[model samples]
Each structure stands twice: as structure tokens, then as C-alpha cells.
Target chain A: MNRLGLGGWAILVLAAIFFITPLVMTATFSFWEGGDRYGFDSYRILLHSPKLFESAWLSIQLSLASVLALLVLLVPAMIFMNLYAPRLRPVFEFMATLPFVVPAIALVAGLSALFTGPEWLIGTPFYLVVPYFFLGLPYAYRAIDVGLKSIDLDTLTEAGQSLGASLGQIIRLVVLPSLRSAMLGSALLTLAVVFGEFTFANVLLFHTYAVYINEIGQHDPTEAAALSVASFLLTWAAMLGVLVLGGGRRPAVGGR
Target chain B: MRSPLAVFFIVLFLAVNVLFMLAPTAMLAIQAVFDDDGAFTLEYFQALAQYQYASSFENSLILSLLSATVGVIAGGLIAFAVLKDDAPRWLRSVVTSFSAVAANFAGVPLAFSFIATLGTLGLLTKLLKTWGIDIYAAGFSLYSIGGLTLVYSYFQIPLMVIIFFPALEALRPSWREAAENLGASTWQYWRLVGLPVLAPSLLAAWILLFGSAFSAYGTAYALTSGNIALVTTEISAVLSGNVVSEPQIGAALSVGMIVVMVLVLLASNLLSARAARWSVKS
Candidate 1:
């Protein structure tokens, strides 16, 4: 209450308005009864549609698969970076972030070109999983890297060695447990991104969750609005959950 | 113990990353140069001189620059207001949180929401029509290039805020306090101490924002429905099997985009490096 001045207030108010405008409009339009009638019919229609449920399932599966793959890839990679290649950390970090900076369409287009034809992996759910890994890599990598940095990895490893623990046992018992919060937070964030991602899903013609938004947009605007509201809530809830659970964790080891 | 298995996994990870990340981009460049018949030519690059393709490039660059500039200015203000100014703690936190969410909010959902608000049958449009103001008739279409920039700015502003906040937080509090204690005005204190310290980061962040806006396709495609021929949508259209069925042309367009992205990435890296040095010195 004391820190923010008039200027700050104005900015906050303006930002809130801008951010909420779309969500509010969508909710209103979805609920507004007009022409024949409305009420909750739009939502009802959305609920009854088998395609909506199917897409939701597909989205969940894809997100879960991607999250699992990211954990497999990132956990070891983070540990490796922490133990050996600290100097190359920034380069690896930059590479993970490359997908974000590149336009989504362009990446999809390039990927489509590279993998189309008899070589076409575009139709496979597994291919979709690949790009999802790239998209989720930065967040997961940063999260794990941060977590790994906070703990004394060298001492822990040595201590485990002295106790006659194998490398696998040491990683599982000492490292993995220590990184629980970071892993949870990163997984949640990755889920949010993969769930909402549309560009690749659309281009690849996949039945992921975001495809439902596009489909509803074309066929039923009202239903689409309802779906958007649901999505906004889902992603928002996931993000908040992560923050609440992982907020108090220490910053990544040696993080500025 | 630095086991051989650990070394093998590390090498394998790096090699796999290079293959996946660099292969597509390299393919783009290779396709741009060679036809299906393996004939190398400058035909695609020459096509850049044509009005259709040239205009798209020019429009993409201009729109990206404008949106990034506007986004950074607005974002910087909000960041400064939250971090440096005597703003309300709750209000600052709210703004920060909202911006983080909104920054990630783009593409179809964003476009659809805007259409609901401002399109011909939009909520605001209907309200304006009731007031006898035909906003559409006044030549304001939400599907135009300018309209896309406006929509893109919505997300970009929050993105800039996110990127710039940490850099702003790195500013020493004593610098501001010192300036204020010397009877300097608020504006002068910021101008002499804050802006100089933050300039490099600002530039780096603006480039990053520019790159993001430039490459963005979802909101642009959804809002404009591929009618607005920016580089991203151009590539999308080509790949959608619509305009150019030839994968080579789609590859060429993608290659062009990667070139621009790489250049932007390089510039941003250099700028960030400079900013890091300044931060260390201060």
C-alpha cells in the first residue's frame, strides 16, 4: 500500500484491464442468450460434444508424455551440467530457449518440411511429442539447473561414495529427492505450455487440447468462448498451484 | 566418480541436441539454395526483390520494430513503477503476476477474445453501433497489419516487463538514493543513474521482444486469417499446402526467417553481455 505511487496505480489498473478484457468478453459472449436462446446451452453443447472430450484426452496424454520425456532428459542433463560442464551451461540454456524465440509457425513449418513425405512423422503423436520437448526444455532445464545448483552436489556424491552407494543409487536417493520442488514446478509449467500450444498442433493436424480451441472457434464461437474460459482457468490453476508449492525453494545454485 | 558412462551421456545429449536443433535450420538453408533437381541458384533470394515478397518482408520488419518499441516502453514503465517507485505492494504484485500470465496468452485464444471485443459483431462494436458510431465504417478493421501489431503489443508488453524486471531489480538501491539525497529531481535521478544502468538491458530486451513479435504467427494468423502476409504466416500459408505446394519455397521462406532470427539472437547476446558487464561494474 505504501510503495506504489499514482503512476504505479495507473499502470496496474491499465494492465489488469487489458489482461482481463479478453477473458471477460469471452465469458460474457459465451453466456449471452440471443437469437434462439443461450443461457448455459453453449457450455452444455461443449460438454456433450465427444470431440471436445477426445481433444482434452489427447492434450492430457501429449502433455503427460512430454513431461515424462522432459524429466528423463532434463534431470540427467542438469546433473551433468552441474557436475561437469558449468561453463557450457549458458550455451545449453540458450539452445533450449531457441524454440521460444523462433516463431511457432516457422518452427512448425521447418519441422514439417524436414519430416514430411514418406519420412512424414507429422501424423504420429510421437513426433508431436518431440517438439513439445523442445518447447518445454528451457523451463525444465532452468528449474532443475536452479535446483541442482542450490545443493552441494560434489560433497553429496562423495558422501554417497564413502557410504558404498552406487552412482544410480546416489542420484536416486540423494539428488532426486532434493530436486522434488523444482521438478514439480517445472513439470507444471511445462504442462501449461504444452496444453495451450496451438501452432504445431494445428499445422500437424493433431487432436491436442489447443486444437479444440481452434475447432470451436470455426464451428461454434460461443462454445469456443466457453472452452477458452475453461482453458484459462485450467492453465491459471496449474500455474498458481506450482507457484504455491515451489515458491519458497532456494534460487538455482550460483544463480544471480 | 567421473565415470565413463557419465561422459558418454553428456556427449550423447549434446550431439542429439545439435542434431535436432541445427538440422532443420540447416535444411532450410540448403533448400533455399538448391532445387529438387539439386541445382543451386539464387532464385529464391532474388524473389525477395519482387513487390509481393518484398512488401511482406518490409511490413514484418516495420511492424515488429514498432510493436517491440511500444511494448518495451510500456513494459519498462510498469517494471520501474513496480520495482523502483513507491508503489503499493499488493498492486505491484498483482501487476507482475497478471503480466506474467498475459505474456504467455497469445495465439487463437487471444485473437478470438479480441474479435469478441472489437470485431464487427464484437461487444464494443455493437455498443458503438448503438451509439450511432460505425467503427468499422470508419476504416478500422481488426484484421489489418496495424491491428495485428496492436494485438501483438498486448503480449509483448508483458513479455518485456518479465524480461526487464530482473535486470531492473539488479540496479543498486543506493544509486537512486544517492541521487535523491543530492537534491536531484526524480526525473534527473532516473535519467542520470537509472537509465544509463538499464540502457544495455533495455536494448537487449527490445531486440528479444522484436524477435518474438516478428516470429509470432498464431495471433496474426487467427486475427488476419492468413490474409495478412507476414513472414510467419507466409511460411505457414506455403506449408498449409495452399499458396506454394512446393516444399522448397516453404523451406526458402523459413530459411529467410532463420537468418533474421540468428541476426537478432546475435545482437541480443552481445547486448546482454554488455549489460552483464555494466551490472558487474556497478
Candidate 2:
């Protein structure tokens, strides 16, 4: 029988070391108190900090808003294309995937260069939903596309049409129900992006959760480390959500 | 005969994307060659040849190239090991899932993790000091290019594993068995049969990794605190209006980055498509 010999085990061990060491050290260092003393004082202070919850709440809200925006924008258009303009699939697919070429930093820079909007527009955090929606499109489109590919879209539409249902009714009553898992997966992917995105928040001066971490990190490394642990867990939770929900066929790429 | 509703929906999608997605990008390109008076100019593009801007571009390229190479080799090895016939199903699933999380577990938290592991007062640094091995004295700084490479490998390697695993999985065992029956040695079998099939996927993965590392902003910003010369940090610095207050230069830098990324991604897509063709044929 085939067996993983010495070389295979060795590679796995090295991977474990490489992957686990930073996490282990970071968790341990989060408890460091001055010289050699160790305690949970950093995390305690972190938990007590008002800004932590405020930033976290803002990030969560942004994530929800972005996901909602993504679904509303993508779902109807995707359904319409599938039902009527199927020939436009290639063009639509190209547009949906083009976001991959636009990095977050570049997008922020571009927006800043072009932004002649009102001061309040750049002043608030909610404006981030726009860029987050853009960043989320490629991933969400992929997930939704996979779902649309699997379902019998034409059959469902025809059945609803024969039942005297209107086009909008067919979408709402028949197709939307089948795409629930896909939408959820896309939402989770978008949630991960909004939660972890820093460049736009930082450059635009929005002070979202990742930007908040950068702020705390400047003076308090321990507290920042504690926050770092939380952020890592947050990403893990969202990624796991995507996997378990079977929304993303391929591993999703996140915003940096 | 497109329904009125479908036509409306399609138009709505196009309008939103053009206004939001395409507008900013087009504006960036426009600003790069345009002055404050809305007159066309190439001053900003010329300014990219300056030392600070030029070096940042050079550093970003070198960093991406180095990190991608390291990720490809290490991740390829790990993928091969994990996909071996003897590896348990649970182990495969665990590695696959871990790669998914780790690949996305980048940016600020990742920077903090590296700092806590390698910084002057970091856990491992202190431990190693007690053993009389001073990494700092040996000219190792976690804020430097080398340090960022190591930190980047954390995500890059996992990303490679995630992307490369499926390609490796498609490499059927029957091909290897056939090669062996044809009196080929293991190394010869791999050289003649395995590497050729995998070459395109490996190249595609490498380029994607390069693009990921090149486009990265948050992790580099957090770890280096803008100390390092990187296109991303440079773009952010200018946009922040504290470094130079030159929006045109920032636009140019970002446009340059966009061009590089577009080229890299296009190449990767082409190679991946070729790889997919082979996979299907096999």
C-alpha cells in the first residue's frame, strides 16, 4: 500500500512550524507586561476600550450594508441575463471579474484623486460600502454564477410563466429561493473583505476595524496583538461560513 | 425579444458599475496625465522616475518576485505531500480548509502576528536572546524587505496550496504507473510526464502569487509603518496629503500598479486556461 514516507511527514512538520509559530508567539506576546512579566492586562484593557467595540460595530455594519448592496445589484441583473440576454454572458462575466485587476490601494488612490464630492461623503464610514461592494463583486459573482449554472433557470422561469406569473414574480417566487445558499456564500465573502479591508479605510480616514487596529498598534503592541487575534478569528469564521455553506467552489480571495 | 424588465435590469447593472467601478479607474488614469487646471500633462509620469518613486516600484517588484518564488516551491511541496495516497482524508480536508483560512488571513492581523513573533521585544526574539543568538545583531529586522517576505509567505504559501492542490489532484496516478511500466525511473517519469503537465498551473500560480504580494497594502503598511519604500505605501502617503500633497503623482503610481496587475492577472488567466485544457484532456 502507498504510504507517506519520511519526506512527506517532514514537509507537514515544517508547514506546521511555519504556520503555527507566528500565531503561538503572537498569542503569548499579547500577554506580555513590561520586561519579562506576562498577564492578560493587554486583552483586559482592549476589552475595556470603547473604541474597540465602536470600530467593530462599524465594521459589522459596513459588512452587512455591502453584502445587501452586492446582492441587490447582482441578483436581479444576473437573473435577467440568464433569462433573456444569455448571449451577453461573456461580456457580463468580463465586467464582473475585472475587479481582480484593481487593487484596494489603487482603488482608494483613484477615488481620492477623483473625489470632488461633498466633504461629508468622504467624512463618514458608510461611503465605504461603495468600494466594498466593488471589491466583493468578483467573489460574489463567482459564487452566484456557480449557483446559476447549477439550477434549471429556464425551466423554472417557464413553469412560473405558464402559471400566469409575471417576470418579476418568477424571479421572486421561483429563482430567488434557489439562490439563497449562493447569496449567503457571497455575503460571507463580502463580510470578510469589509472586515479586513484597511487601505481604503485608512487612506479615506474612515477608522473601520482594521484601521482601528493600525491606530492601536502604533503605541500599544500588546493590545494590538490581542486585537490581531480577534481579527484572525473573524476571518476564519467568515471563511468557514463560506466553506460550510457550499457557496464558494474555489477558495475566496480577500481584500487586504 | 428582450423583456422590458430584463432590459431595465441590464441597464441598471451597467450604469452602476460604470459610475462606481469604471469611473474611479478612468479618473485615476485621467489625473495621472492631467494637471490641476484640467489640462493634459505628463509631469507626473516623469516624476515616477524620481528616486523615491522609482525605488518603491523596484522594491515592490523584487518583493513580489522573491515571495512568489518562495511560495511556489514550498507550497508545491506541501501540496504534493498532502495529496499523497497515504495521506488520510481528514488530513487532506484539514489542510485544504486551513489553507482557505490562512490564505485570507492576511493584512493587519497578519502584520501584528509577525511583529509579536519577530520584533525586538517579541516572544521568539526574547527566547532566542536567552540562548545567546541575537537575530538583531545578525542584521535581521522584521521591518525590512526580507522580514516582509517571511511574513508574506504566511499567506502566499497557503494561497499556493489552495490553488495548486486541485491541479495536483488532477494528476492521475495511472499516468505515473504507466510511466513506471515503461521502465522509467521515478525521477525520469516525473521529468518526462509530471512536470510538463504541471508547468502551466505552476506558472499561473506563481504569477497570481506575485500579483497578490504586489497589490498588498495593509500588511506592508502595518509592519513597516511607511518606513519601507513600496508603491502602495507611497500611494497612500500622497493621498493622505502629509507626505507630498501631490495627488497626480499618487494617481500615476496607482495607475502604474494597475497596469502591472492587469498584465500579471491576464497572463495568469491565460496560463490557467491552458492548464484547464490539459486537465480536461487528461
Cα-based TM-score, every candidate: 0.92, 0.95
Q: In terms of docking quality, how is candidate 1 classified?
A: medium
List model 2 lDDT by residue over B1-282, tens digit each: 468877887888888788777899998999899888989999999999999999999999999999999999999999999888878889887898889899998898899889989988788998899999999999999999999999999999999999998888888888888888889888897899899999999999999899899989999998887778999999888888878657899999989998998899889889988888777665
Candidate 2: C-alpha RMSD to true structure equals 3.6
TM-score of chain A of each: 0.87, 0.91
What's model 2's lDDT at B182? 86
Predicted structure with the largest lDDT when compared to the true one: 2
Question: What is each candidate's DockQ, to 2 decimals?
Answer: 0.51, 0.69
Q: Which residue pairs come into collision in candidate 2?
A: none
Lowest lDDT block of 10, candidate 2 chain B: B273-282
- Candidate 1 C-alpha lDDT tens digits along B1-282: 467767776676677567666676666777778877899987877776678777778878988999999899988887877774555567666766666677777777778877777877887788789999998999988888777777887789989988988898888878767887888887897788878889999999999898888887777777777666788777777777777546676777777777788899888889888888767664
lDDT of 2: 0.87
C-alpha RMSD values across all candidates: 2.8, 3.6
Model 2 lDDT per residue over A1-256, tens place: 2358898999999999999998889888888898869999998898898998898899999999999899888888998898888898997888787677888888887777677688777767898988988888988898788778777788777777889998778777667767777888888888998888887888888878998998999999999898888878878888889888863443232112
